[model samples]
Target chain A: MSTIEIAGKTLELDADGNLANLSDWNEDVARELAKGEGIEELTDRHWQVINYMRKVYQENGDAPSIRKLTKESGVDTKELYSLFPKGPAKKSAKIAGLPKPKGCI
Target chain B: MAEPIEKVSIVISHGSLEGVYPGLIMANGARMEGIEATVFFTFFGLDAIIDKRMDNLGVATVGNPAMRMPGGIKMPTWLGAIPGMSRFATYMMKKEMEKLDIPPVREFIEMIHDAGGEIYACKATVDMFHLSENDFCSSLDEIITVGEFYEKSAGAKIIFT
Candidate 1:
């Protein structure tokens, strides 16, 4: 594990860069993380995906895969790639402060 | 720093819902990891790309020794051979996948394509099945020979499902 200082708080992150402690997540932390991923601004659309992921994780105990994200997160697949380029599911989960979604190779 | 995996190629050889999903899921997962991913649909796997059949792919319950119920109980092969069992199993699996928000096969393929993953149909399989390029989903990248596929897949991790 490694630590990243976000919003004056040092938080542990797994090797995959996912938050080690889900409780350490906040909007500020998400913004910090998103900045590192090349997203300078967090639009409402971005929040929609992050909030949906966090809600589903809290209920299902794991982050949803890209399939679920695109289908149920009010974000289409094309918009997801544009919102979280390269790897939407993984990147969004990191910004949402959730674990790396299971079933992703 | 070590280089992350660059590419991955998956081969889908079976037609059942159970058979097709592993390849799709793995390819999607690879793309989620920023790895270039490709899926080669061959033989029965062609069912997944066939324009008319892709959306209606069914589970193969008969002769499948690994069939299981929702509670994880093993289903006997003999019982699986009963009429409508395959359709019933497909329905159950589809329901479970829907609950988890997994897209159906056709949409899944489109998602992969839109995500920049490549979809291929085996040329031999297409010829054998009397299917032309028009018979496949529009997302199909190409129908190439096994030799050509191997050439393109060289240096990439290969997975057979």
Candidate 2:
């Protein structure tokens, strides 16, 4: 595993440089991304999508598109954003422990 | 935004004659752009997969105003329920496609298959709808569930019409 500090918070990632949060990412990372700082709470649905995204990144070596993620996880895009607030893949991906996906920036 | 890579996997969940065409058209368009494409047919969308009915498809009329001629006239949704509507819609769509130099649905399917695109049927939808493999085109890749489709769609873009 490795770690990288974005803003003031240090994020722990796996060997493949994936998001290490897995299914437990509350809003800490999300708050960090959204407010460009830190967070305190996250929902179960957030963890579900983050974990699924991590799995997908591992297998495909890339982040799944929002549409694919929604279809796979059966989560609506609106619900996904409500959880992330800033953006689903951007903040969620960071907390999930994934490297910055190409084409997203 | 990054130009989407040509490696997109598209899952189409429509089976109506008109509805089914979008799936095929987009799949073929993806291939034309050299993107990896896949089409999953579920529910009534299987009508396109069924070899017997593929050649005959219909247009959307219910609450749909685009079902008119070049003059942009209005037509009834119930008109699509008529016997000949399917055939007429099929012909009209084909004609418009030909005018645009787009391939016919059959040819488009074949092109997609030959170009390494995938075609699948929804197993649950088939079971629920009382459809069998024989009802679909012989070129199908598999009869999969939504989960399988999701897995396949991973890392790819999805366009739903």
Candidate 3:
């Protein structure tokens, strides 16, 4: 893990660039985190996936996979990829301050 | 760390659940890692993209070792040869996969395609099986020859499953 300055706060990020401290995340932090992932801006659609990921992680103590996100996360696979270029499951989770997903589909 | 490879071109040569899933899973996994991926269905692999047979494909239970019971007990060869054993094995495997949220064959194809991975059929295999363009699933990107496959797979790692 390492530290990066965002919104005037030094935030610790894990190896995958995910926020190490949950309390360190805010909309500003999320936007900056997303920018590091090559996402220029967090539109409403992007927030949809991020918020869903945070909610699921909060309730289940883990992040949902791509299947769960597509099936119930109010977004389909195509749109999810468009929103977060490559792996939406991991990318969106990082932006949501959740750990990386470990399972393979 | 740097990405090991840029793209993968998977060749699925088997029709059974064990045969086809390796290629599908690999391609889908590649896309998940932000790598380009493509699946080439040839020979018995055609069964995977064939709309009429895709959903009905079964795993091999006969004349095979490593087959097992629910608790991991080894399955006897004789038991595997029973008339309905293959179907039963396929059923059990599907149920297990469902519990893990693995999508069915058709859905998996759609997932890969939508994730920017390409899917295709071998022209020679399609002809050998007396099949036509209309026989494939809607997600199939094209029906090409071995030479065409090689061309499309240029600069990509070739994985035969």
Candidate 4:
């Protein structure tokens, strides 16, 4: 476990770097996290994925997998990868302050 | 930073709905973790890449000893061979997958490709089926020989399903 300080608040992260407490998530925290992920800017497209992930997590009790993220999140698979780079689902879930997706590995 | 399992090569050899999905799901999962993924389709698994048959994959209910009914009772193989049983099983499986937001075969393959995952069909299988490249989905990267697949899979973790 570790802590990342954002906007004067410390938030917990698990060993895999996902937010330990979902309640600590906010736009500011997401922006800071995104920057660390090589995204200097969080465009509307980035927010589209982030918000969609958070919404789905709230409804489903887990982050959407990459398949669902691409098909139902209003972001195509190509765009999602470009926006989040490397691993879209894991990165977006980290930025959205959600747990590591259930079956990401 | 050290490269985390740089690539994963998966082989899908069965055409049944159950047989095909594990490879797809694992490949997709690999991409989600930033690992490069490649899926090699051969034998009956070729159905998963065929343009017309990919989306219509059916469950192999007959002779599957592990299949069970909704209440967890073992599904007798005799019952599985009844007409329309395969279709019913397929529908039930699709519904379960849908409830979990798992995509259909076509969309799943597209998602893997769009995410930079490589998809391949076995050349011999293509020849056996008399399938042209056009018979496969556009996302297929190529139809290559087994030797060629092994060459490309060098240094990667290979999963046979």
Candidate 5:
């Protein structure tokens, strides 16, 4: 079991990726998570991925892959590249406040 | 690994539609990194956030050499406003979005708001343009002055693109 605190609520991530504290998650948590990722300012496009990721994680209890993110979020791969400039997985996941993704290092 | 710098706030000011997207794109990028992002629309830039003309924006071809056809056929600035040209350019942009599979501007703005980010309109520009609050896009949180905007964006990065 693993523990994470988002927006002042404690959450648990089991081996299967289930959230024990789903009610604690909210847009404010996403904002705080974004803040921790170094996003002090925000834009409409940024929210697109953050919101989608939160929804996907809450539903599937598993993080989205880059391909799944693009498909589900409806943001173009090129535009995603342009938005992240660094690369989608690392940067986007960081801002979305998800845990460090696998295979990112 | 190197440690990361703290979040930086970026301010984007633009009037033209073509010019505005860069600001939007950059601001979105910054937000993804948890950086502070603010966009200030003045004069023509205000037109972009305003409801009346956001969907129907013009392009800049006068000085852009890269904006050419397959064989480097440069487009003229005068042609940008030639009746159907604005619509054509808008359509071309939409087509590009379709090709990239990016969402529309409306959806993008909604995403920002849902994430608890802020969107503000320029008070002075709004007054100068004779646009009431009702004329602005529904996503706007408030109408603020340059000074107010500066205060909010201070202590963060600033970008004018």
Candidate 6:
């Protein structure tokens, strides 16, 4: 476990560097995490995926896989990779304040 | 930390349903992990890229000792030789994979292609099988010679399945 300051709040990060507490997530924290992931600018498209991932986690207790995200999140695979860059499944989940997805897609 | 895999080149050498899925799954998994993937379909594995037969791929129930009944019960080898056994086995496997959200071969190929993974057919195999470029799915990037395959594999880990 490690802690980092985001938007003036000290937040604990899990082993994968996701927010340890989903309740700790906010728009500001997301921007900070996005920057850390090299997404210097989080556009509306990025927020669309981030919100969808967070919603899926809230209902299913886990983030959606890349396939699921592409199939249902209104974003396709190429765009997902472009939006999140390397490792869309893991990187998006981390930015969405969710655990790393477990299974291979 | 382990060094990340930047690129992977997979060679699929067999044509059976079991033969093809490993290469497809691995290539797709590599792209999901942000690694660049190139799939080379060669020899009998060309069946996977051929539009006419790709969707109908079946496990060879006969001679496959690992074959099992629907509920994991061991099946007698002789039963696998029945005319429809291969098709039946393929149907069952597809249903099970669907429950896990894995797509069919056609969709899987499209997914990998749409995600920017490269798919190619082997030139030697294509000629031997009497297949033209038109015989393959649109997702096939090109029909490449072995030398071209090696060129793409340069600096990348090569996996043969």
State each model's C-alpha RMSD to the native: 2.9, 15.7, 1.2, 2.3, 10.6, 1.3
lDDT of 2 by residue, A11-75 (tens): 67666455466443444554444344143555678678877877888898877754455557767
TM-score on alpha carbons, each prediction: 0.84, 0.54, 0.96, 0.91, 0.58, 0.96
Which stretches of model 6 miss by more than 4 angstroms?
A: none
Tens-place lDDT digits, model 3, residues A52-102: 999988998988877788888999989988898778888898899888977
Better of 2 and 4 by DockQ: 4
Tens-digit lDDT string for candidate 1 (B116-141): 88899999989988889888889999
Return the lDDT, model 4, position A38. 89
Residue B4 in candidate 3, Cα distance off native in Å: 2.8
Off by over 4 Å in 4: A7-9, A103-105, B1-3
Where does the lowest 10-residue lDDT sum fall in candidate 3 chain A? A96-105
CAPRI tier of model 1? medium
lDDT of 2 at B31: 51
For TM-score, candidate 1 versus 6, the one ahead is 6
lDDT: the better of candidates 2 and 3: 3
Candidate 2 residue lDDT tens string, B64-143: 66677546666677875678765676677778766554555565675566556789888898899788777777678898
TM-score, model 1 to reference: 0.84
lDDT accuracy of residue A66 in candidate 3 = 79
lDDT of 3 by residue, B1-161 (tens): 97589899999999999999988889988888888998999999999999999999998987678789888999998989889989899999999889877899999999999989999999998888899999999999999999999999999999999
Global lDDT of each candidate: 0.89, 0.65, 0.89, 0.90, 0.62, 0.88
Report iRMS values in order: 2.2, 14.7, 1.0, 2.2, 9.0, 1.2
Candidate number that wins on TM-score, 3 or 5: 3
Per model, kept true contacts as a fraction are: 0.77, 0.00, 0.60, 0.69, 0.00, 0.63
Q: What tens digits encode model 4's per-residue C-alpha lDDT throughout B111-145?
A: 88998899999999999988899999999999999
lDDT of model 6 at residue A31?
87
lDDT: which candidate is best? 4
